[model samples]
Structures are given as C-alpha cells and as structure tokens.
Target: MSYPESLERYAALGVDTEQALQTLAKTPISLHCWQGDDVNGFEGSTGDSGGIAATGNYPGRARTPEELRSDMNKAGSLIPGAKRLNLHAIYADAPEIPDRTELTSEHFRPWIEWAKEQQFGLDFNPTCFGHPMAESGFTLSSADSRIRQYWIDHCIACRKIAADIGEELRNPVVTNIWIPDGYKDVPVDRAAPRQRLEESLDTVLAADVSKEWNIDAVESKLFGIGVESYTVGSHEFYLGYAVKNQICLCLDAGHFHPTESIAEKISSALQFVPSLLTHVSRGVRWDSDHVVLLDDPTKAIFEEIVRCDALDRTHIGLDFFDASINRIAAWVIGTRASQKSLLLALLEPTDELRKLEAEGDYTGRLALLEATKSLPWSEVWNEHCRRSGVPLDTDWMKDVRTYEKEVLSGRV
Candidate 1:
C-alpha cells in the first residue's frame, strides 16, 4: 500500500515522511510496563522502569476495575496516537503447576473489555520459568517436569486467551512467546533440547491454530544467568522452526550481540519474514528496555529503521519501560525520534544503493547520509505533531539536532 499524501507533503520538506509513516503504520508501538511489586530486586530493572501494583493485600486490598481503566486511559492519553498496549506480569504466587484450564476468557474479560472501550489492543508476556525456578540454571530439557509443564501450560493459557479475545473482538489477538530456556554450560545432548523446543512450539502452534488464533515466537538474547554464550543456538533453532511451521518471528532490537550490525540483521530477518515486531531499549552491555534514542551511533538504531522502512513491515511497537521522566514525555520523544530516524532512512534510494553495492561502491551509503544531513528536525517535529494533533514540543529540537549532527559525522 502506498503512503498517504500528507506524508508526502512532509517528505517535500526534506524528511523521508512517506517512509516514516509507512514504518510507523506497520508496527503499532507499545511499551512493556509490567513490573509487579518487586521493583528493587527485579532482574530486568534498568534506568527506564515504571509501574503501580496490580495486586496486593492490605486495607486497600484490590484495585477496582475503574482504577485499572483509568491507568490505561492515562497511558493512552500520554501517547495520543498509540494503538496498542502490552501488559507483562510474572505468575509468582502459583507454586503448584499452572492449570491452563483455569485460565479462561472470563479471567481476562475485564481488561480486554477496557482495552476495547479505550480503542487500544492488548498483548502479554509471561516471565520465563527459569527466572524463579532454577537455582543454578534451567534448561528446556531439564529433568524437572514441573518447570516444563509450567511453561507449557502458560503457552496454552496464552493461546486460549488470544483465541478468546479474538472471538470477542472479532480480530486476532497478538500472543508472543519468549522463553529464557537455553543451555548454561556444555551438556551431553544439546540437540535433544532443541528437538524438545521445536516439538513444544509445534504443539503450541497446532493448539493455537486449532482455536483459530495467531501466535508469534520471540527469539531473544539472554542475560544475568552467568553464561556468556546463548545467542547462536536459540535464533538459528527458532528461525528454522518458524519457517517450517509458518510462525512469525518477533524481533527485539536490543537482543542482538554488540558485534552484529542492526541494518544487516533487519534486512536478513525481513528476508525470512516480511515484518517484525520488537521491543526498544538502549544498552551496550545488557538488554535494558530504555527508550529508543540515537544517542549512540555504534548501535545503528537509525539505520535499522531505514532498512525496515524499505521493506514495508506491518507494525513497529515502541516497546520501552520508563520510570524516570514523565512516562508521557518519554513516549512522545521516543516515538518522534523513531519516526524521524525512519524518515531519514527512507530518503535513501534503495535501488540506486543496491546498484552501488553490486559495483562495490561505499559512496552510495555516504551519499544517502549526506542527503539526510540537511533535514530540519525542528520543522519535521512541528509538522508531525500538528498532523498527529499532539501538542508541539520545541525544546526537544536541540537533542534532535545533536542526533542529526552525530549521524552526519558518521559518529552514530
């Protein structure tokens, strides 16, 4: 589908407006703000984190549905144009095996109803069983049947929930599965775990398809388990499995190794699947869900956006966890920056660049960079906010200029 003419008007002002809008349209950005009470010692805590308790026992025991709706509405108002919201929580209290049968449409009905009323979509992620279960390390092929059953049941519940919601709303519910199940140390039978994982996924997808719901398998890099190498096996295994089973790959930008190029990775991943959904975070050492920013050129966040734009992906969810600044401000800034970077990337003539690559010309990339050098960030931001009907914030232009300078200097 072609971009709207309004986007073309922005492109005339020297922004890759058409590409930016297209990239943003493909991915409905959502933030992952699910920290359940254990903030101080949460394993994934980073500079960006925010949440209010969803459950507790005290004088004010339960939060009313109105309270929940208010919180969601507030988040929606903050973003102004966001179309989806992701909720993540760890099922900590259930020590016994999780009962998938207990999970019903009724359980999530209230939240789903609220989301529909508010005109936003819902997605969820359950913490890996290994995070709380393993004292040393947990493998998918672990001898502990309880852990395996826990994960299996969780997936089953998620699929059921997605199917139920889809039936209720008459549209597909996006269910994402990200397992921390990986090898910690060298073991006898690596292939067995891989086989088990494939089988498990196949079963899950089969069950999901039986219910007429869609399932997306998310392959990510692991952290905090003391084992350094967990990348190659998981991705390769999942990609192969997804291809065979017709599953979608959910790509997270922060999960790649430091040495890998984001642009190259996006291009390669898109070859396998037409589009990808990802969580955004900033970290050189660890997977911190920081707001997406071009502060570091080495990360190539901007270039990745450009690559994805050329491919015309389905949706780009701005997955971030924020605790420091006003969450609303963070969302606006992050979304604007992401859109800007994408627009700049689209300005590049891909066909010309391909020809240059075939002839071994580094100058094509440099030429694209130079073309984006004169882009007016302030004007672009102003025009976009006007078009989107969000209040314009001029102060952010300074950082935008700094980002542009860094990009032009090849510092990014």
Candidate 2:
C-alpha cells in the first residue's frame, strides 16, 4: 500500500505522507442511514423527505428489532458487492418513551451479527444526551454535578457498547463524537469544555485500549447562530488539543464557509492529525450539506481531490442527505462521483503541475483544467467502475447530469 514516488516528494515538502498515503490506499466510504425517511415505507418530514420539522418530532417511528434486522438484510442484499458497509445510529436524542433502552444492545446486536455474517465493518456515533446544551448556550453555566455526571455516564455507556460489539465481531469499529457544546452568545471558558471533552474521551479510550476503536472529534461550523463559532480555527484548536491526548479528527466538508478552500483546509489539518475522515456535501453561502457533483466545475472539490491524491490521503467518507431521491441512491451516486473525482486526480501530471506551482504559474496550473476539460467523464466513470469491479450502466451519465442540475438549482 505504498504511494508513488511523486507523492513521496510531495510528502517531503511537509505534506502528510503517511496520512495521505493511507487515504489513497483505501476508500472506506460508509453510507449513513440517518435520513431513513427518504426510503419508502418510512415516515418523512413535510415539504422535504428528511428535513428538520417545525415540531421536533421527525415523521418516523423507530423500526422494531425484527424490522430493523429485515431492513439491514434488504440493504445488504441491495448492495451485495459493496466493499464495506458502516451502520450509523438511528436516533440523535433519547426518543419519547425510550422504547428498549436496555435493549439498545439487542437492537444493534442483530446488525452487528449480520455484518460479521456478511463480513463488512461497522461505524457508529456515541450517544451524548445533552445535545440541547449547544443550542441553549448554557453548558458552562449549568455546572450541575448531575448534568456533568450524566455526560460522563453517557460516554461510558457508549464506550461499553462499542467495546462489547467490537469484542463480539472482532473488527475495527469507530465511535464518532460530534460535540454540540459551544456557546451561542459570549466567549465562555474554553478550558472547561476542552477539559471535560478530553476527560470523557480519555475515559472511553482507557476502557479498552486493545480494541480497534477510534474516537473522531467531528468539528462542525455554524453561521449566525453562536458566539463560539464552529469554524476551521475551532477544528484546528481541537486537533491540537486531541494530539496532546492522541485522538482523531473527522473533517466535514460542508462545515466550512463557501469562500474557504477545502483542499488547503484539509492539507493544513493533515499536518496535525495522522488520519482524516470527511463528510462530502455541497454548501452555498455556508454549511448547508447540499449534495453536489464532486467534480463540479467550481474546481474547489476537484483541486482538493488532486491534493489528497498527490499527498496520498484518501480515507474519505460520503455524507450526503437530500430529500428528493432515494437516500440509498444518493449515497451510491455520491460515492461513485467521489471515486470518479479521485481517479481523475490520480491521472493528473504532477511533475509538470508542481513545477508550475513552484514558479507561481497560476495560469499554467489552470491549463491543467483546460486540458482535462474534454475528459470524457463517461470514460472516467467506466474506468472507475472497471477498477472497483462494479457494474456500469448507460444511465450513469444521465444521473451525473441530474446531479449537476441539482447542484445548480441548489436543491441538493
């Protein structure tokens, strides 16, 4: 799984060699089923298949254990040849009545058992009960021992469940922790949250050091909503904090401002974190999570893929949630588009490009774009399909065009 020499040279220039190479060697993209309502038979939000509802209640009820198992089996059957499948949790908050809290283990037990039976890895998020604290902007003020203890207990429970599943299946399982604990009005004592977060992470990490579990601190950026902004600076702050304690970073593409360069941001983040995981989605004025073409002519995503390929960092995760198409289809299309973009980037003539970059030849580098302008995207798609051993169909170009149209219309 060694990278090419060109990438090694790029690494010598202070680009993350190992992280980049590891990313290039693998495309462990996982499909998230967070918006299950987009699929048929499930309830949905009004005006959109899975958008936020006026009432906090999303339009769907939880599927029973038997039904969940059946759905997993069906989803598995639909994509039998997929290289891997990662299951996300069903709820963000403790649902009304909390049906089967003790059976939380039982609910996931079938899916875990099924992945083992079918041989695919599983990734999940730790259950943090106090998500409202981020919006309420009072995490620091509460200082309530009970609230603090609740957070501690939730982390322990999440780790215990992850360990139990990992031990049962003997596979690498990821526990992603996306914090919603920042302030909304004034600058709070950053040290307290950082200390609590690190303490909670240390507690989880210490429980089973031998288990193949990773804790990814997912940094999200929000606009016009909070005093403590969720910007790239915040992400950098956490990565530096995590490095002090040996943790991982999950980079979300949609979490950046529309003006930011995702490639440069990713490159900068990689300088600190050894491994990278990102959510792929488009945004307009801010972080909107719109699903756009990975190779959109805007060139933001294309350039990022090129840098990632040149640096050999390819550990990408597809995070797409749109209400129009089938949720499963959105994931499949997004994954395919991302792979197409990466393969095209790999085909780039790096030696010439690097020379132009050194000489401050922005126009010369831009020529690479014109040269690739006539890149028969169909050929790229076909090549990707062939390399990945996936089936190709005539409808792919149509799908790409439809996706492009959605990007233009800002529906995705």
Candidate 3:
C-alpha cells in the first residue's frame, strides 16, 4: 500500500484524506449483472433481441444463475466500497414468470435472497425488447394497441416487483423503463408514436407504490441497430415526462451524441427533476456499451455532482456488456473506476476553486484545476483498496484467470 507521505501531500491543499476515504466507502455504485452473461438472460428469448448487441465471444461466459452470482461474488470482492446490483427483468430465474407480461415479484425471490447474502442494494429495468412483440422496432410506442398494452403491462409489473424487492432489502430500487421504439425511415407522422408512448407511460406509472421503496425513471436512446433514423424515447420526450410526473430522468452516457457532455447535464436536470439516474457507459461511435474507463467524461461527471452538492439526489450505476474480454474484469474495472472518480472528486479543494471563480479569478481557477491533475491520487486509491480487503494491484487478474480455468471453463 502507499505510504503516509502521500496523505500529507493531499492535506496541504486543505483536503481531508480520512474524510475522503470514508465518503468513498459510503458511495454505492450499482454493478450491472448483464455483463456476466452477455445480456443473454435465461428467459429463453427470441425476436428483435433489443438494439443492445454485445460484441466478441471470449470463452467462459456464465450459463446459469448460480454461475453468474458466483462470478459477481468474485468481482465484488475485488471492487471495494459499498456496491449494488442492477438487474433486468429478463434475468429472473423462476419458473413462474413464463413470459414477460406475466412477471411477478415471486419470480425474483432467488435474486433477493442472493442480494441479501451479498449485502447489495438493488435496482431493476423492464425488458422492452428481445420478444416477438418488439420485432416491429417498437414497443410502448407501437401503433398497434395490443402491442402497446402488452409492453405497458410488463413495465407496470416490473415496478411492482422492484417495489417488493426494495421493500425486502430496505433499499429503494431505481426501476428504469427503456424501450427500443423507433422507425428506420422518416415517418409521415412522427407525433403519433410519441403521443402513444405518453399515454402508455401514464398508465404504467399509475401505480401508487411508495416512493421510499421504488423510484421510477425513464431512459431515452439516440439510435440503435434498426432504429437509425429516429428513436421514440428521445431525450426531449423523457426529460419533459420526468419533470411533469415528478420522477427521475435517466441519463445514459452512451444514449446521446458522441461529443455531448453528460456531466454538464447533471446540474441542469437537478434544477427541475427530483433526482437523476446515470447509466455510466462509454460510446465510441454509437451506443456500443463499451466497458467504462476512467476517461475525462467519467471524471468530470462525479466532479460536477460533488460541485453541485447532488450526491444524495444522484444514483450511480454501471451499464456495459463486452463479451470479448473477461466479464469479471469488466465489472471490477468499471466499478473501481467509478469509485476512484468519486474519491478524486471528494479529494478536490472545491471550496477554494469556487472561491476563485466567485471573485472572477479565472486564472487561479484554471491553475488550481491543472495542478490537481498531478496530485497523489493513486496512492490514496492504493490505500483504499488495501483497507477494503481487496487487491491493490494486478493481483485481481490472477483471480479471474483461475476462475476462468477452474470454474468458467467447465461450463458446456
């Protein structure tokens, strides 16, 4: 682990090292479960398999619920600090929920029990694609009334399940609704589909579940494999709906233009929306759902959250699936990057920077910002991993290699 000299260097800037560690320990990042199985849920699904396409097929993907959970256990051990599990409706490992429309809380009992053992907070998302119903490249916004109602029922049912799970765990579940609804060609009437989506959302959210147990959020998309021309749940639509309904709006990092600043949107949304749900993802050209890295955007995001004092109102979660590499490593890297970003943000001398800005001393603000880039951040991170009882170096890769050889390789 790093020495005490690194801590002293951070203190010279008026930042408290011990307090930053404690704050990082309490910040819970939701680890996405889809990475374990390449988004191939055990629902026996078909049809338009959503627009979410996980590329590359490295050997040894988890094939069962027990296997996936075991893999998560290994990844969780290496990723320190508080952690949560973000699940999809399709991941339910029960015989009862034979179809998406008939899903119930009972179907997720196994998951709830597993979460209890892992001591993880929970979050959920409704499966709006990968079924015969969504083949038309639309779900809730489909012109067909029957198609729209089926998805609406599924979404409403998912919220109930989320509420029950959150009630059991005593941690509110952020139930997000995202649909692959759009058209490939310029629509003769664009307003009709969005209008239909509006009514369906109103019906789905009609449930009176306690906000303490379940917080609802709506996710929007830019474009997908099939829906290249338009997406029904665009940012404008969901932003308006979330504000009007007094709910949270989910800002997925990959769900916008490549150059768009997701970090900048946090303060903008918090000004009107009750809360925010961030799906921390990295996009190259489109929503490829690449494994998240400690890039500039990721760093800027948490810094902005801290600067605006919106930690309590913000929910941080991972959203990526890359089948080409080791799945366990993907989880550990992304979750750790998020934790590291938060730690870096907490260690910032924000008061001094803001004080400079308030006095219109732009030179001082920029100078301090540049100097912060060379601080002893890695030393603090090394100590954090040491105290969290996780590996502080490349030792984690050895664990994944052993699991791949002894456990994952055994799967047929």
Candidate 4:
C-alpha cells in the first residue's frame, strides 16, 4: 500500500500518522558507545570483565576512541530522528590518563565538542567495573571500607562531571550508576554488604548536584557472569532506593528474568519514582546483550510508556552489544529497531483502546487490537525513512558492506 492508503487506514481508527512521525522525530534515543568496542573502554585495564562480556571477535572492533567515534558517526547517519550519545567514564580522553575516581569533564572535552558538532545530547555512566578495584566482583557493596570508598568517590566524580557536561551543552544528562557488586555463591550475610552499599550511595549522592544539569538513576540486575547466585543491586534494592531518594529508576530490558516484563515494571516504577531510564536490550535466556530487533518485548516497552503518557519523563537508551555482527551495523540495526518500535507505539490508537476498555467492551478492544496489527504500518515506516533521508528498506545494508570493504577491512 502507498503512504496515503496507510494514512487513511490509521485515520479511520483515529490515529494521526503525521503526529506520530513528528513526535518520533523529536524523541531522542541515546545510543550506547560501548557497543562499538564490546564494552572495552579506553581505560586499557583488561582481564576480568566484571561479569559483562561481549562474545565473538568480528574484525574491525574499535580499539581507540577515534575509531569508535568514527563508527558511531557512520551508524548515526543511517538512524533517523534525534539521537544522544551515552558515554562511560573509562572512555575519558584527557591530556593524561586519570583513574575513574579522578575523572573530570576535562577528560571528555573532545567528546563534548564532537557531540556539539553533531548536535547530539550526551548521557554518562561511572565505570564501576572492569578495573582492578572491581576484580573481586564487588565494589560499592564490598565489606572492605576502602573498596567501597573508592567506588563512592568514583561515582561522585562522575556525577559532577555529568552535571558539568550537561551545563555546557544546556541539556540535562542522565547519569546512570550500575555496579557489578554481587557474590557468585550464596553469602552467609547479605545484609552487611547491602548496608555498606546503602551508606556508600548516601555518601556518593551527598553532594549537591543540580538536577537542571544532571539526572541520577540506579540500574538493577537479577544476575550476571560471576554474580549468578546473588546480585547486590537487585531490582527491589534499586526500586526502594530510587523511591526513597526521589531519583530516576533504570529498568534494563535484559536484566530481569525471562518471563518478566519491563513493560509492566514501567507502570509500577513510575508510580513512585520521579522518572525512568529504560535500557532497551535483547537478552537470550540470560543477560546476553544481543542486538535488538523489532520483537515483541521491544514493542511492549514502547507501547507501555506511551500508554502511561510517560515519554516526557522517560529516557530511552539502547544497551545491547553484539560482537558477532558488524559493530556499526549492530548500532544501526538496534537503534533503528528501537526507533521503529517507538514509532509503532506512537501510531497506536491508544484513546480508542482505552475507551473500549473503560466502557467494559473487552470484545471490541480485543478485536480492534488484533485487527490493528494487519494495518499498513510498514508503509508508514517506509515514509518515515524516506522523510528522514535514510534508506527505506534493506538498502542500508549495502552501505554498511561498502564501509566494511573500504574502511573496516583495512583495520588490522
């Protein structure tokens, strides 16, 4: 069907395709930088990935900050709509290397300048893992006071730097904190470590960082590589902490149990927390960060957020890292899939569905829901790509292949 035919169908259901396109175009989806290099940041401290692992070598994986940025630039060109760059503290590029604890905005001036040039917003994360301090699989929640203090200082510095970057860019940055603090085996005393974590978090957030520049968020995980038995920062832990502190709560798509729905969690978290940060990732069985597709889980996340009218308060970011495929293609594919899901949700006839449910017309709601699936949403998607000046279909793959031949193949 043509674009007009698709629009007519949506209009019949009280859906405004034009409005959805406009809203989607304005929404900023932050892309994770670590995907380009399989989470190996510029810190150069290798060995023991702190429970985060990106499988497969696939040649041309970015080995330097410059290469990663160039790859991101290539991926960004094919992805439509507003975009933001998410950075880890380990990606710092300063005159001299500084430990995570001592990182400042000066270490990221080059990144900030590049982001400005690209007209993209910036988000940040404190590198809480992959360093010598996190080799024990515990950092903030460690029983040792010294270990906890180091991570606390690192988080504080990251928050300050994030705020500074946001102030410089005039866009508030979401500084999310995720720690690989957990025990592989069942701990005799879980309460002690949790207590330490609570205390350390209070100290780290004690500084008065302006919200106008920085938005603080805490991410939770069910389990990870070495921390399978017990994850220190579980969902309940972060939920309670976020609510108590009135901070944003991060719900990673791949961090929960297989049957669990991040879509449901959005409604629950937004009830208490001021805002939310969603890390849209695809997890296979475990938290295997695979490239995202326009799958059911991805669609549900965006649908729920739109239904709850929470887009303004929700920050959407991609968090998958698949090394088996082309790194730049991974970015483009995951990001574009996310964008398509959001667009699908935006095009939903939410008011009609709600009205049917409110009137106890479950039959109509069910029928309408199923029937809407058959509509020409693909046509609308094609129009979106065309309007954005990107490839309307799989043609983007040709561009990526050309890049691989001309650039990536040359990389040793």
Candidate 5:
C-alpha cells in the first residue's frame, strides 16, 4: 500500500495519487482470449493460423469455451481494475461448425451470456486468416472476385455480431479488421491489391451500424512470415483510409519496423482520425507477439496518450500469445504491466513539463522528465492492488502455481 510519505511526495508535484489510482481502476484493458488456447479457435482447425504462430507446447491449454473462460477468470482475479475480453470470430460456439461467411450473433450467444455473468465489457475481431478460403495468402484484397467476396461477407457478419454483443453488454465493442494480404516477393502491381482492399472495406462498413454499439477499426502491418517483400495493408494505406472514412485506426506495437514506435504516432493520428485502438504487444526481433513487458516502448505508449489528454479517445487492448509458459500468468503479467505503465503515466507532472517546453526551457523539461523516472509510482500501484483486492507484487504468482498443480494439470 502507498505510505503517507510517498503520497505526499507525489502531491508536492501537483499530481494526485488518488486520482491516478481511481482512473486506473476505472480504465478497462481488453484481454485477448486467444492466449489461453494459442489462437487455436473452436472451428476444428488443425494447423496454425496464417503468418502468426504461437510457439512452444506448454501443457494445460484451454480446450473448450468453458475452459478458456475459467482460465480467464483465474487470470482476471489476479489482475486489479476493470477488464474486457477480446474475442476472435473463430471462438464462436455452436453445435454445428459453420463456415466463416455463415457466422452470426447466435454462434456467439454463449460468449455473450458468459460476459454478462462476469460483468465485463467485450470487443471483437474478424478472423481474417487460417481458413481454407484464405489459404491462397490473400483475403479481402485477393484478385479473385470469389475469394475476396467471401472474406468481405465474413467481415460484414462480424461487424453486425459485434454490434449485437455490444448492445447486450451496453458497451461499444471495437471490431478491428486485420488481414494477412501481401506478397512474399515483389509484386508487379502492389497498387491493385490495396485498391481492392479499400473497396472491400467500403462494402463491409456500408451497413448502418450505430457507433453507440460498435466502432470500426482497421489495423496495418509492415510484414508477416510470408509477406516480407510487400504488405497490402501497410500503415500508410490504413492511415489514409481511416482518416478519410472517419473510423478508428489501430496501431499495433509489433506491426512496424524494429526501430519504429507506435507511441510517436498517437498525437499525430488523433489529429486526423476519430480515435485510436492501440494493440499493446512486444515484438522480439520481428512481429513475434511476445508477452508484453513494462519496457521503455510500452511505457512510452501510455505516456504519450496521457500526456496528450487522449485517454478518452484511445482504446487499449492486449495482442500477444505465448504458449511457452503458464498462459494465465502470461495474461496477468502483461495486463498488470500495462496497468502499471498507465499508472506511471498518470502520475506524471505533465503540466509542468509542458509549461517548460512551451516557455523554451528545454533543459528544465529534460531534467524533470528524467527525474520522474525515479518517483514512488510503484507504491501507488501497490495501493491500487490492495484496494482492488488483488495481490500486490509477486504474491499473485503463488496463486497461479497452485492453480497449475490443481486445475491446469488435470487438463491433460
């Protein structure tokens, strides 16, 4: 818990420790459900999805909707503050398997019911990869009219399903569209695929879905496993489309070049796009989707958002899958690290820094920024976890280890 001395130290800087804790408590971080099952959805697929693959063969992977939810419950119990579950289209539950194009809200009725019971918000994504239809390495942007139309219909259905789920939960669900469409080698006509993608997106979003229940976002990638030469949905392509269409632009931390940072794009994108959806992920070497750590890159993301006063317009969601370790612990560690970064960002003396920058006092600005790195924000985080009834520090790991022996071990 936060001591009096720590609280007073932060208070002297014109920052409110109580306000930061409360804001962090209210802020909902969307946890990706696929982590529990290594992105192997319930549609009876045998192989790993396109481009993205979760490495390792760790035991106790969730095998059913119930098991996944149970794992999520255990992870959520260890993480303090509000949370929302991010669902992929393939996780849809139904007695009979339905193709991606034929999916509806009924297929996801079980998930909706579970989320209602848990009292958590929900978000959705159209599974644009892994199906036989997408085996050609292109989906919405495929030159073949038949292949492209099938994906377009699937995306349309996903948006409507997202609306119904959001309406049921009374929270607007962010339905993000990310497709693995590109070429491994240099293509003669890169412009044609991007043009087709734009047209397909226009048709998918043509339906009159209310923003009150659903928000549309387009995600971009620099390259994937096979698409190293050229990616159809490049960052520039989606940024232009999102800005022109007035939809949300999703910036993934792992979707860019190694040296690039999504944190620097926050303020720039918000000036044009209506809102931003940030996928908090760690990219080791390339877009490996490693478990997120509270590293400098992740910290800069929250810092920029809070510094720009764009928390209300930005959506935060986790996007990583690691099958190497305890999945539940992966979720708890990544999510708590994100929440801690947000807390540190909130506790910053932003006004003072901005005042210095505005007055051309660059020396003071740098000095204060460096000094903020050594503040007692960790104490404030402990206080938050204490109030929220979650374990503080590594105490939460003991619960995970016990669960592994009792619950997860029996799965095999």
Candidate 6:
C-alpha cells in the first residue's frame, strides 16, 4: 500500500502517522556487541563460570575486535533509527597482559575511538563473572573478603572507564553491574550474602564519578544457570538499591518469571528510579538469550513505554545473542524487531484511547485497539527505513552471507 493510503487508515483511528514516523526516527536502540562474538571478548577466556551463556557454535563468530566492528557495521546499516553500542569490560583492548581487576579506560581506547568514528554512543558493563576470582560463583557478595575486594575494584574501574568514554563523547555512558551470585540448592543464609552485597556495592558506587559522564545502573536477575535457589541481586534488592542510591535500574525482560509481564513494570519503575536502562531479550523456556522477536511481549513493552510517555526516560538496549543463526542476521532481526515495536506503539492513537478510558468508554477503548491491529503499519516502517537509507526488505541479509564467505570463513 502507498504511504498516503496507510496514513489515511491510521488517521481514521486518530493516530498521526507523520508524527509517529518522526518519533521512531530519533528513538535510539542500544545494540549489544556481545551478539557478534557470543559474549567471548578478546580475553580468550572460557571461564564465564556463572551467568547465562550463549549456546551455539555458529560459524563466523567474530574473533577479533576489527571483525566484530565490521560485523556490527553491517548490522547497523540495516537497522533503522539512532543506535548506541553496549560493551562489556571483557571486550576491552588491553595493550598488555589481560587483567580483569586492574582494568582502566586506556584498555578500551580502541573501542572508544572506533565508536566515535561510527558516531555511536557507548554503554558499558562490568564483567563480574568469567574469571578466576568469579569462578567461585560469587563476586561482590563472595564470602572471602579478598575475592570480594577484587570484584569491587573491577566494578569501580568499569565506572571510571565508562566515565572517561562519556566525557570524551559528551554523552552519559550507562555503566551497568550484573553479578551472577547464587546457589544451585537452597541457601542456608541468604541474608548474609545480601548484606555483603550491599556493602560491596557501597564501595563500588562510592567512587566519585561525575554523573554528567557516568550513569550507574544495577541489573537484577531472577536466577542464572546454577544460581537457582537464590540470586543475591534480586529485583527487590536492586529496586531498593536503585531508589536509595539514586541510580538507574537495568531491567532485563528475560530475568523475570516467564509468566510475568515486564511491559507492565515500566511505569512502576519510573516512579522510583531517576532513569532506567532496559535490556530487551527473548527467552524460550528459561533465561536463554534467544534473538528478540516482534512477539506480544516485545510489542507490549514498547507500547507501555509510549503510553507512559517515558521514551526519553527509558534507555532501550538489545541483550540477546542467538549464536544459532547468522550473527549479523540475528543482530538485524532483533534490533529491527525492537524498532518495529516502537513504531507500532508510536502509531497508536494513544491519546484518543486515553480519552476513551477517562470517559468510562471501555468498549470503545477495546474496539479502537482491535481496529488498530489491521492498519498498514508495515508501510510506515518501510518508509522509516527508506528515510534512514537502509534496506526495506530482506536485502540486508545478502550482505551478511557475503561477509561470511569473504571474511568469516577464513577466520580459522
């Protein structure tokens, strides 16, 4: 259908197509770099002892930073709208021997420089697992003080690195902390570990990083692989911490109960937290980071955010790494799915729907919502892609296959 024809359909529903398209254009989706390399950064370590792991041996996984960047570039071109790149501390380009604890921003200079070239804002994370110290299945909340101190230093260093990047880029870099601290069986003493965690976090956040450059965020997981009985950084713990510490809460959609709806959690979180950083992912049965889809959950989350008028307040980032498929294709699919959901939300006649609810017209509200399902949203999405100078169809995947043949196949 023509753009004008689609616009008229949406207009009939009291939705402004032009305004929706513009809103979708500027909304930034933070694309994760881990998807290109299956969370294996340059460290060349397989000690991701705890936490969720990307489960696939997909060929053409980018081994070097250069390859990763090229792959990200390919995926970024196909993605519509603004984007920011999220990095883990493991992705650091250390000039010398790898040191997880004594890391600095200098170790990630190459990343900052390249991100600058790409005109992409950078976000960062502290790798609290996947090292000798973290192999004990704990970090900040480790029973051993020395081991706990190591993770603390690492987390503190990450904040500084994030601050430097943000200072140079002149945009706040979100430094998120997600520790895989839990047990396979029931824990005899849960409160003690949580107390230790509270103390360790205090030391980490005590560093006087400028808020202008750094936004501190703590991610809570319901549970990870073996850490089933208890997660030290549960949602309740981080929610309270985020409120008291005045930091951003990083919510991963897949971290909650499968039956739970994270879309419904947006407004509640915004009320307490200063800002929010969300990691959008899809989980099949558990917290398996499958590639995000344009499913009901994904669409509902974006719709809720739009309805809450928290688009600017919430930072949306993709966190799934589906190594089972073409890495670049996975990136494009997941990121595009998110963009499509945002576009759908923006295209909704939210104001009219709200008016319906306010006037106690419940039936009209459901009717208008049901009617929106048939509107030509694809036309607006295609138009957005055309304006962004990206592919409007499956043409982008051809580039990925070409890259796989020319660049990736030769990796071994």
Q: Write the per-residue lDDT of candidate 1 for residues 100-170, one digit (tens) a residue.
A: 33455565566677768876666655444324443325433344767666566667767776676676767
How many collisions per candidate? Answer: 8, 7, 0, 0, 0, 0
* Candidate 3 per-residue C-alpha lDDT over 295-385 given as tens digits, one digit per residue, 9 for 90 to 100: 8988988999998999999999999999999899999988888888888999899988999999999999999999999998989988899
| Residue runs of model 3 more than 4 Å from their true location after superposition | 1-3
lDDT of 5 at 19: 90
Model 5 Cα shift for residue 315 (angstroms): 0.6
Candidate 4 per-residue lDDT, tens place, 327-359, comes to 999998899899889988998899999999999
TM-score of each: 0.71, 0.68, 0.98, 0.98, 0.98, 0.97
User: Of the candidates numbered 2 and 3, which has the greater lDDT value?
Assistant: 3
> RMSD for each model, in Å, please?
9.1, 8.4, 1.2, 1.0, 1.1, 1.2
The lDDT leader among the candidates is 5
TM-score of 1: 0.71
Predict model 2's lDDT versus the native. Answer: 0.49
- Model 5 RMSD in angstroms: 1.1
Error of 5 at 63 (Å): 0.8
Q: Please estimate how well model 3 matches the true structure, expressed as its whole-model Cα lDDT.
A: 0.90
lDDT value, residue 257 of candidate 6: 90
For each candidate in the order shown, give its overall lDDT on alpha carbons: 0.51, 0.49, 0.90, 0.91, 0.93, 0.89
Residue ranges of candidate 5 with Cα displaced over 4 Å: 46-48
Summing lDDT over every window of 10 consecutive residues in candidate 2, give the lowest-scoring window: 42-51
What tens-digit string does per-residue lDDT give for candidate 2 at 271-374? Answer: 66655566666665755555556555224554665655533343455554566544434555565566556555555556677888899998999896576555
| Local error of candidate 3 at residue 397 (angstroms) | 0.9
Question: Candidate 1 vs candidate 6: which has greater lDDT?
Answer: 6
Give lDDT: candidate 5, residue 336: 93
Give me the overall lDDT of model 5. 0.93
User: Arrange candidates by TM-score, highest first: which order?
Assistant: 4, 5, 3, 6, 1, 2
User: 1 or 4: which has the higher TM-score?
Assistant: 4
